[model samples]
Target: MPEVLFPLDSSKPFTDQEKIGHNRWHPDIPPVATIKPGTTFRADCREWFDGAINNDDSADDIRDAPLNKVHALAGPFAVEGAEPGDLLIVDIVDLGPIPQEEGSLAGQGWGYTGIFAQNNGGGFLTEQFPDAYKAVWDFQGSECTSRHIPHVKFTGIHHPGLMGTAPSAELLKKWNKREGDLIATDPHRVPALALPPEPDGAILGSLSGAEFDRVASEAARTAPPRENGGNQDIKNLTKGSRVFYPVFVPGGHLSVGDLHFSQGDGEITFCGAIEMGGYIDLHVDIIKGGMEKYGVSENAIFMPGRGGPVYSEWLAFSGTSVTLEGEQRYLDSQLAYQRAILHAIDYLTKFGYTPEQAYLLLGAAPIEGRFSGVVDIPNSCATVYLPTEIFDFDIRPGADGPTQIDPGMGAPRSANPNL
Candidate 1:
């Protein structure tokens, strides 16, 4: 075990922890600690919702999930001698769920994948799944099994959902301006387009009173992926991956949280991924002026590791830009992917899975989503691939039809009252 720089108590609230972390991204939140360039450290992370979400059979927690306080990040661990224009190299050495504990808190031998209700925060398929749903999964070694769903077991690709270097004051201002401008367009929309900085539930490390107020009001919410790399949610960032983040502030304030035991591409559900609270062992180094050296300035870039679960045969589904209602859009890759996922859900229903269970499965399972065609005319073609081995029976089409599996209780659902 490496030095536990930021230790979290699963029994305590995130705010009550000894070493507090900020949910929002701001340069002035201050670093919890400083480390040299070649240091390997361990940081315990709280699940995004802390302990608010229970390991239960209700989707009410998912329905009423706290959207304001999120992505309870571990730190803005200042790297000694790092400066603006430098590139911060982060290597994901290892990570997993909380060890040797089993209880209510997520990652204590279990975790969850949730579908956020439309009124809260709509997901990729929110229009199709307007209500909230949840699937609790139990961990056995490296694999997880869900009672809410059935007949599926697979290895998880453990990784952090949120990790980044802090933005400089100027860069932070840019984020607020753009996101605020976008929000101004649809300020009253349910699950607003972009979240603005809220002062209500901010935990800015050791800052207090007036300073906290100023920082919280101006800080960017940790929902969207920004130049500083807040929540990119790339499932490929498993162990042995190396991410290069552009340093926009002195000391390169690197922070990480929102760990996931497993996630498909896109994290289609808003609360997608087998959300967990876990520890990450990271090795950090600096590339002096490497941002300009690598011709990268804004977004973080990375070389994904090859340690993810391997499945040679995949049952794939494809979709075009046409919407479920038959409305066609031009070169809409995003819409194409959505249709592909919806098609997968529809197909899974043949096996007796409720749409919610199938949707949750697509979000948590290591399904591969890709663009099969984008250059052609009015429609982009997207495809989603599911590993055949994860399921007990054959999912392919033949003279023998789809095998029916018990969906158990199905995914627990809560209808949106606002609807």
Candidate 2:
């Protein structure tokens, strides 16, 4: 019989800290269970605020919500037989929202603020909309009625906030020590000691040594981890999508938190598409050669790859450049650009297209590239766009299967070649 790993419980608030340890599994510390590839598990996830904030709650409610109590998730269940250097293929079978109180809004819209910025600009409304800005505009009113843009479709996609194997014990230990030391230091010592005497002078002494020690103790409790082992918000895993994670320790302790309903790419504002929760159905499958490549790395997920000769309404290129002062910034920018393009080409070639063919296709299409950001360290990124009308081929299918090529790869390739 299939096991009910994380059963649904509606009696408790979702974001309660005590609930995380009770509901989720950690890989390195202890083993949850061992399961075969086809084993299915159920996850009972909580709303983003664990019922702290409601849909009818105002922005003030969000601002006042406890920061630590936000973004709760369920389970780090172990897939039996999953070992190091193996991949756990997860297939999402079903996701449903458990009915809440009558006036409660359990699941709602989903999207990321960062993705919105990619399409729009990054700024508050003062900068985003300076003049004639209407706080609430009616679509059926004169302005929108005269415009050609019409409402099409809207979807709310749900995905996890945090999902990954626990870090090795050694790493966690080192993190505790380093962060612990920093937290033991006081931030207000210098100012407190340097305060000038008032005219009605009462010389205020510095904090007692014992008081300083206490301050450090409190700060240490809230210090960010010395290592990046804490919560990570990767908004890619959605309902019906599969995530392959690398296993570290036995039972591959896995923990998840931070649930968003729908989000755009980039997640710029540190907030996600929509913060809500419901139920998630997870099927854990073990794959050989999957675990060896686990953990966050440069080449893991967001590798540069050519997407198309597929059509786009408009073509645009975007990139970022980094510079070392007193050195060649432009040269570095050029090198970064080349690297990004090469990476894209390398990714595209994996789809069975010859290097030369991919290059030609990129050149023939209405491609445009531009700089994205340059202020960060080793700044870099480049995006090329090609108009959809130029190429009669599809790029979406390339993700699932091998690309089909004509007998002789050339400008006039087959319109529909058998794969």
Candidate 3:
């Protein structure tokens, strides 16, 4: 079927705390038609700034811009028929990064805070590796110099800052009642969901327990309106990935914000190619039977070769193991891995695969089984992998017969002696 386009505009500026509730923003160009299981729609997205930052802005200008205006989303597109129990499957068809026009002073480039800070301030490395850094580059010139050092090569790519479905009203309300005040009114309440500490005490969205506790504690102290609830700045998702979200209400209230030019895994410096303003094209579909019973209720599915959804896969396996382990060493890393394998077996058996077949596949297929953090106390590990390529093969459905024979016996017997 032909793809439809949906354009959305935000009604008001959304904070990291207020974005949790539903229908916060209105759709500018409503869906020309309803989207179903097979229906596909192309969503056009504007930059996080919503066109605020421009090429003419300087490093000082960027550093001085208001935090509230940083990452703006394009829409609250309605997925017709989407309900609490349904799944919204989004296929990233294509992404077009905003190009840096020639001769434009817009510091259009890709880098995290470290790269930018190093460029502006000649810190530790400037004295020792005097020739390693450069503040600016001449795009047209074939050669460029950085403090007498010569270099070449420049390409810019922008990625989404934040992209996720709206949380349920109940979940949002609970979160607000628990952590709203700290995020809204208390400057000391900035929790560390993913960022690091800046000189200003707490950097919003940082990933730290202390920061998170302060934010949560503050939220409990004073109840603020639903802010950007369920909002986080994850820059790992790029082109060629699929993000599947669970529908919490009819029409699956969907929204996206935060745009980056590029970022590394883990987003170490807490900031990335922080350039704003760009276009994105997203395809929407419905996933059949994609939700779990409880615990964080969102199912994000990435396509083949794209590892963006690794977190979701790990969570699924971890949750299963947690339930199975009960009080028996559930906190142990090695034990958890073993239990996870058992969980996988149980899952496969439910799909009609024999225990033996499940075991074979678990060992042979792309199922990831590994020990990651054994050095730290209460070591933790995981073994789980999803093979997107398996669907492309056309192999026979049943198990093979025994391949060995008993020399003492007259002839070989089937492994399944019952047969």
Candidate 4:
């Protein structure tokens, strides 16, 4: 257990005190608490749904989680001695899910994974994955166990899905304008799905039923990361990772939420690996004029190692395409990489990775990528390798999965050369 920094009891659940929490990330929101540099604290946290979806939820129940009411954040816990232009260093100490059993809604001890419907039009592969789906996970110390999401049987790496300091007024204005421009460009707002503010903390960011006088929106969104660092679902930011954020506001109104029991790099599915409620043990420090020293603006993170890397052998998949050469083929990598990843993701689903689960697996698990062949005429090749040793159970190519020669693929595409 981490040392609690708030006036509240450590034994209490974070969801139990909604008033102390926050959904918006604006600098205007009142700070919950303030601490100087080198301050360490234990923060109890919640899932993206803010406790709505839970274990035993049907696929429908999970998919229905309001998209507008996205990631419910915790704390604008102000850093006392921090200021703008400086860098805020958050050293992640530890993380674990809430362990609750036998309840209409149980969390902390376990978490759930979900894929929304295409009607909502969310997620990276929303078109291919048109239906709603759900899977539950039970998290013990250091690992997550789930029979629901098949194929993976490794101990999980627990990390917060969203963590960062508050955005300044300038940044908020810029976000609104950019999002507005994007919305104007396309009404659907495909990939540039900017979160506009909505009434009610998105799920209330306050203490024990108390409401903050604000709306939850893009600035508060636990989605795209900014200089202040909101939601950059990097799976490697686990215990011992040193995260650096460029301070934008005074006291660096720091907030954290969107805890993931586990996740992969791409977070391809909008939902993510295993959405769970957990606790964060963080050590906060301020680096004077550090942002200036870095020679660039915006927030960035430095990870020493995620739960320490485990060396292992891998099963690799190759992707072939036209022209790895020249600027005209910049889009080739996108097509090639997408094909390779899809191949890998589809292959994993056979052994328990749901389309969504498999997407998450490709991200969270230690996979490597390489450019295999560039000399094959006008073709370039890439490969994404999955470590075979990561799976605790013996993982043979299951019946459900398509082998290397999946239909429409595997055959050399040398006819049109660019095909």
lDDT for each candidate structure? 0.92, 0.39, 0.38, 0.64
lDDT tens digits, residue span 1-419, model 2: 23555544556544233323222222222333445668776666666555654433122333334434333445546666766566656666555444333334444321111101211211111122111100000121101110011111223334555555544445444544564455457534311211111112111112225543432222211112122223444444555566665555566555554555443332322332344455666677766765444543211232221221223364344434433232435435554554444444455565555443344333222245444555556555655554433333443334467455341422222222211
Q: Taking the tens digit of each residue's C-alpha lDDT, what string does model 3 give over 342-407?
A: 566566545444433333333322234455545544435555443333322212234652222111
Candidate 2, residue 178: Cα displacement in angstroms equals: 7.1
Off by over 4 Å in 4: 6-19, 99-107, 189-192, 200-220, 306-311, 320-329, 332-335, 349-383, 390-419
Which prediction has more favorable lDDT, 3 or 4?
4
Tell me each candidate's TM-score.
Answer: 0.98, 0.50, 0.47, 0.80
Better of 2 and 4 by TM-score: 4
Task: Name the better of 3 and 4 by TM-score.
Answer: 4
In order of listing, the candidates' clash counts read 0, 37, 27, 22
Model 4, 73-187: lDDT tens digits are 7687788778888888889887666543434333456666665565553565666665666566665665665555444555666777788887788888787787667667766
Q: Per-residue CA lDDT of candidate 1, range 22-58, in tens?
A: 8998889899999999999999999998888888888
Evaluated at residue 264, the lDDT of candidate 2 is: 30
Instruction: Estimate the lDDT of model 3.
Output: 0.38
